[model samples]
Target: MTKRIAAGAPPGLHRALSIVEETAEGSKLWCAAAAVMACTGGRRGRAAAAAGLASVATAQLISNGVCKQLVKRRRPPKEWIPHDEVEDRPDSSSFPSGHTAAALAFTVAITPTWPLAGALCALPAAVVAVERVQSGAHYPSDVTAGAAIGLTGAWLTRHAPRLILRHWL
Candidate 1:
């Protein structure tokens, strides 16, 4: 993983992170989802969006939890200074990044109804994953695994809303 970063992180990763971190842009995505749900009279749409958010959060936890426990990798050595360009500093395990996991999970959940939105979400996720490596907070492999966990969780969450409503309705 280190070797890969050493070789080179992807192009435009820094720029992508910058775009996502903005308060307006990031919040807009959430607002858009909320608006879409709200417009449908807060029935199935709202329920699904809420459930999807929870699923993404849960998936991030599981992914980060399992990976951290298994890998038990420490942060980069103190002597090692991260790439100057990377801004986010996460003082956690250097495996299966939580941010990447969360982003991918959210992307997965939103993709079905809003393909364009999902694609937009993915841009930041990819950048954040790369930033995790540049910031010395995650190995490339760790980000990859986190992404898998997130995507799987998002998919599972997608159908969970219907099952939940089935009982209550």
Candidate 2:
């Protein structure tokens, strides 16, 4: 699949994906979005932004700090990718894509609080997922695992406080 995408995708799409993927590094894009929401959006937007940022942070910790530490999977082979961007992939374990995890975490966390903004975020989240595989930074399974982690992170961010209070009280 990675090979097919690397070879078949047009130069224009490759450039676009590259830009998107680059912007996503270290969750920079999501952070920027959160800042925008917090600054320009009213009360609801601030709440949504807070939720989204929390989820992103949780997802990053789980995906990059914990999961990647436990898993030692290598990235897709360079030979499988046809682009120079493949060379720029990190040496860290590729069993889960941190970018995808962060992207989905933010999107999912914001949805219940702000549907319109969540819908807008969904596109870039999807792009980040695809770019993980298309850029040879991860296999599809890695992205899938990352997505699951992201959803779990969002769920935790949304309900953990209530759950903890319920358990303790």
Measured against the true structure, the TM-scores of the candidates, in listed sequence, are: 0.66, 0.98
lDDT of each: 0.62, 0.92
Residue-level lDDT tens digits of model 2 in 1-169: 8788667778898888889888888889998998988888899889999999999999999998899999999899999998888879899999899999999999999999989999999998998998889888899999999999999999999999999999999
Instruction: Compose the digit string of candidate 1's lDDT tens values, residues 16-132.
Output: 554554422333444455466546634655554665476566676677667677777676554353455433445556777776777677767766765565676666667666666
After TM-score superposition, the amount by which residue 123's alpha carbon in candidate 1 deviates from its true location, in angstroms, is 1.2
For each of the candidates, the C-alpha root-mean-square deviation to the true structure, in angstroms, is: 4.8, 0.8
Model 2, CA-based lDDT: 0.92
The deviation in Å at residue 117 for candidate 2 is: 0.5
Per-residue lDDT value at 147 in model 1: 80
